[model samples]
Target: MAKRQPRDTLPTHIAQWRDQVRRDYGIEDAPGLILLEQAALALHRAEQARELLAKDGLVTRDRFDQPKPHPAAVIARDAEASFRAALRDLQLDVEPARPVGRPPGV
Candidate 1:
């Protein structure tokens, strides 16, 4: 018989991501939960991108044509961007992604 890999465990990145929700955010509320959900989604997306990119950038192909711009890459990138935007919007003076420009009137 051959040894089989363990299937009762999550991937490394997925484990870390799930662990993040265990942090104490002082007050437990819907907003906090929402943040965690958003973070998880972002992490998932980034992981997808990493996996796709690691595959020699070939992604997928068919007998007729090959997809350009990398479909997975686009999805992952968009998910990451959406996550960042959502996180920024949920800002309660926490890690705000500052815009590099003059504030309205220069």
Candidate 2:
């Protein structure tokens, strides 16, 4: 019989995303790890809110029978912004490899 691998403590998507980010960015410090976690959670929240918005609608009728943007739209926007901010804070949103020195003829 094959030995069973231990289950991941984190949810599947979270673990997969975190591991991929870590591998892709070579994140090793505590602060980077924390920021990655924050970014992941924010992204998850944004996706969930987006899904709710899709299921319901982009607009809804208020008590006065006036149509307004769905509340989930705001939530999704905020969460996605938070995720982007976290990535910026972590310096993970930029190009992977940048040239180190000035041009030879400049």
Candidate 3:
């Protein structure tokens, strides 16, 4: 059997960094807010790429494959939302998602 990769690594890092940054800056929201905003943008770009790939029929799998958002996009959005929610819980302002324009051919 293949060994499973650890799932909690990134979240652990994020939480550790968030705490460190908070302590260093003496501000509750400084770095966490920034990280969340960055993560959100990454997610948006990833989602766009996934849409593009799907439109172009580049990704395929057997019928038994459960449909999922393209991996990168899913990771990005999940990370972004998780961080954003954390920031919100701490009362930080999070930028909303901007609408993406249609692709050139569409």
TM-scores, all models, native as reference: 0.54, 0.73, 0.34
- Candidates in order have lDDT scores of 0.64, 0.86, 0.56
| Order of models, best lDDT first | 2, 1, 3
Model 1 lDDT, residue 49, Cα: 79
Instruction: Flag the better candidate by TM-score, 1 or 2.
Output: 2
Query: Please, what are the lDDT tens digits per residue for candidate 1 over residues 1-106?
Result: 9999764344677657545543544425677666656666676777777787777484566556865556777877887887677556555344657898888877
Off by over 4 Å in 2: 1-11, 94-106
Best by TM-score: 2
Task: Give residue 70's lDDT in candidate 2 (0 to 100).
Answer: 97
lDDT of 2 by residue, 24-48 (tens): 9999999999898888888888888
Q: What tens-digit string does per-residue lDDT give for candidate 3 at 1-106?
A: 9999864233445456655646764664556566544544444554555666667555445578965445554554665566566567655556776669976787
Cα lDDT, model 2, residue 24? 92
At residue 32, candidate 1 shows an lDDT of 65
User: In what order do the candidates fall by TM-score, top score first?
Assistant: 2, 1, 3
**Measured by TM-score, how close is model 3 to the native structure?**
0.34
Instruction: Tell me the lDDT of model 1 at 6.
Output: 69
Residue pairs of candidate 3 with colliding backbone atoms: none
